[model samples]
Target: MGLRSALFAAQYDAAMRHAEHEELSSRRAALLSGLRGIVYDVGAGTGANLPYLPPSCRVTAVEPDPNMRKRLLARVGPANAVRVVDASAEALPANDASVDAVVFTLVLCSVPDQAAALAEAKRVLKPDGKLLFLEHVRDAGAHAAFQDMLRPVWSFAAQGCQLNRNTVAAISAAGFTVDERENFTVGPAWLPVNPMVRGRATPGG
Candidate 1:
């Protein structure tokens, strides 16, 4: 909410809207196919996932930026099925394990505290519920090193986005047993890390 954050917010929102859920069109269908009741979507900018979810499901979409929420309100109507709240990944304004499912697509890399965010996700998720995720993480080997080296500048420009976060390790450390993860280079190395990572995590019974 300070000067730097305010400026960061402006650019970050533009980057997000420019990308505009480009990665979700295909993966979202599969991820959202089995959902039933209450759902939480972390970093739910523009409420793009609003339509992919089931009709019966009630989405408590958490987004921190007021400006982004203002824009999101235009795209996603204020229906009973959707309730948008101003919140951040570090702290969720929800009861523990209250939601049936949680979706985090392309949000964690940009989160300031990935571990804390994941821990919060774990805390708020129901025992039987699933944490569905889709992230672009650091590649393995030399490319991974490049991701780390470039992160300083990348983060500055992208508003906290780190190019080098390992999706597998971070989620595991957060207590979310990974069900699946894949690595792919949609483009070149050096800049703009591209490793499409998708997986699921569940709380221990």
Candidate 2:
């Protein structure tokens, strides 16, 4: 990884530690509860979603940043059914139609090409497979304006994480049919990236 990627990975866990509170934990568990069979966890930073996953699922964690991968390896328990792949979201290592489900939690915002990443996710998923996502998106009104204004500086500081990504639209455009969705506000109201969406999408019609 480059210097900026290295620095982000090094401090990633610390930067996000406070956000790993009870509320988010509960939400993650709920988001992951239905997943089963072979799963690919894109952007599995520090393996935050590992514990929340069902034991029936075998997870392939795709993370490109070396520093984040180090912490991710440390977080994986000996008994956990997770394999780490050093790959970016736009180029997953999995084979076509191989995985039962693909998981994306706070990932789409940071990828250089959101459409390509989602396309890759769709490619690796079986026709009957599902996509599980928990993402913060561009909100409406004043908060949206704020996110637009702060995006340049925020993306620089937060390692390419855009504060104003319309992730749901991108997912739909990638050909997944959204089946269930829940939208809510998270963190303090003042935060630009506070509006979040958690949902499940299935491949094909």
Best by lDDT: 2
Predicted candidate 2 versus true structure: per-residue lDDT over 1-205, tens digit per residue: 2888888888877777767673467788998997889999999988889999888888899888788898898889676768998999999988999999899999999999999999999999999998999999998899899999999999988888999999999899899999999987667877887888899999876
Q: How many clashes does each candidate structure show, in the order listed?
A: 0, 0
lDDT, residue 26, candidate 1: 57
Query: TM-scores of the models, in the given order?
Result: 0.85, 0.94
Query: What are the runs in model 2 whose C-alpha is more than 4 Å off?
Result: 1-3
Residue 154: error of model 1 in Å? 1.1
lDDT string, candidate 1, 31-120, tens digits: 777798889888886666776888878788888877667766766775545788899998998899888888898789888888898888
